[model samples]
Target: MSALLRAEGVGKAYTLRGKRVDILRDVDLAVRGGEVTALVGHSGSGKTTLLHILGLLTPPDSGRVFVADTDTSGLADGALADLRRTRLGFVFQSYNLLPQHSALRNVVLPYTGRGADGERHARALLDRVGLAERAHHLPSELSGGEQQRVALARALINDPPVVLADEPTGNLDTRSEETLLGLFRELADEGRAVLLVTHNPAVSEAADRVHRLDAGALVAEGSAA
Candidate 1:
């Protein structure tokens, strides 16, 4: 199968004080279906920035991002939003769950226009993520692991082909990190393109492929299984 997500010659820069700092430069990435690709880099190395560009959350200063072979550079804001809603799923370092909503409600929020069956689908996703029992619990009422599981379930609710996560396990303990990593692997096995930005060695060990970002470029690490 072809890559579900691609970035070619992508570059970004920001003005810090009087200097123009380059975050990424001529970076090329290909996230294929049925694989978990881990991006490892130090702080301020632009891992999350690249993830945002791949997810269409931020536009790169140069180069192109392709989702399912469709170049996103020319898409209008509305079109980009539509693609993000229908083609991609994102998970952040923080759970980013609504404080006032139940886990089930949070999962269903993305499926708002799907009518009444949305709840059923959300419940099934909760079950898939091993959070069925916590469906009605608030974020405050759940453990960090449980809250992250809820976020994972919510990301999968749309069944998007590409899943982008940035430092998703940053706040989790070792066991919780392992649990989430397992889910990510499972998603890859099921043919979703899973890309996550993480500094953890365990996270890279669990992936099908590892890419290290340094000085605004990506270098493949290790061989694929």
Candidate 2:
């Protein structure tokens, strides 16, 4: 199957101390449905930058980003925002939940649909993430794993086909990380494309395909053996 999200010859650079430093150069990647693609790179290797661009939160200095067949480079910020709301999901290392909100509330916060149906879906998602009993708990009452799971459920509120995760397991223990990976696999199995950025070997091993980056360039890529 073809990728639902794609980046072609993408490049980005920043000026630091009057010197130009390339964060990414000529990077090409494809995230297809039913697969988890892991981007593995060292610090400063531009993994997060590439993810931001792919998520439409940032634009590349050169090249183009494609969502299905639509070129997103020329899109205005409002268009990009609209596309992001409907077509993408995001998971972050910090979980990004509101401290004052219940798990159910946090999950339902992203829903752009009707409140009644959104609550029902949010409840179902909390159950799916193994947090149904804790649905009323606030972020302060949840463990890191539980909070991350809450964040995961929130990401699905819009039923986005593409999910982007950045260091999602960086704060979790081994057991939590394993559980999260299992959930990710299930998501892909359900026909969503998952693009994950990580520095963890276990995370990379769990992916269907792994991409490695170095010094602003894609260095290697392969399927898990």
Candidate 3:
């Protein structure tokens, strides 16, 4: 399969108290359709920075990023936002669900333009994540795992080709983590490219390939399975 996402020589830096702090440098990465690529690293190791760049949440100081054959280097803010909304999915560690919305409503938020079928699609995604019975529950009423599942369903509601997950199972129990990993595998099987940033070895084990980062650079790439 061809690459669904690609990043070449990407770099990001931030200024802290008049000092330059480099987050990532010369990073080259790619994710093909139907693959799960795990980025593993310790805290403060630029994993999240790399993920943010890959997801287009933050632009790199220098480098080229392409998603689904579109080069994003010179896109304006509005155009980039449109690309992100239409072609990408995100799952964060915090779940990030709206407290006021039910599980189904949270998933439907991404499909507002789909008219009447949004709710039905949301319900189906919830069922896929094993949360059909909890569809009406609010984020606060659900377990951490259930909340994460809702978030995952919301991420997929758009049916984007690429999913970027940042520490997605960081707060879940072992069993919950296992369930989420299974869902991720299913997504990959359906030809979605998954790039996940995780510190957990168990999570990395589920990936087909693992890339390790340290001190603002990719240090190792190997098979996790």
Maximum-lDDT candidate? 2
Off by over 4 Å in 1: none
Report model 3's TM-score to 2 decimal places: 0.97
TM-score of each: 0.96, 0.98, 0.97
Q: What is the model-wide C-alpha lDDT for candidate 1?
A: 0.90
Candidate 1, residue 170: lDDT: 92
lDDT of 3 by residue, 45-143 (tens): 999988888888899999999997899998999988887877899999999999999999999987836577888889999999999999999999999
lDDT of each: 0.90, 0.95, 0.91
Q: Which ten residues in a row have the lowest lDDT in candidate 1?
A: 216-225
Q: Give every collision pair in model 2.
A: none
Which 10-residue span in candidate 3 carries the lowest summed lDDT?
109-118
> TM-score order of candidates, best first?
2, 3, 1
RMSD of 1: 1.3
Best by TM-score: 2
lDDT of 1 at 87: 88
Candidate 2 local lDDT, 47-106, one digit each (tens): 999999999999999999998888998999899998898899999999999999999999
| Number of colliding residue pairs in each model | 0, 0, 0
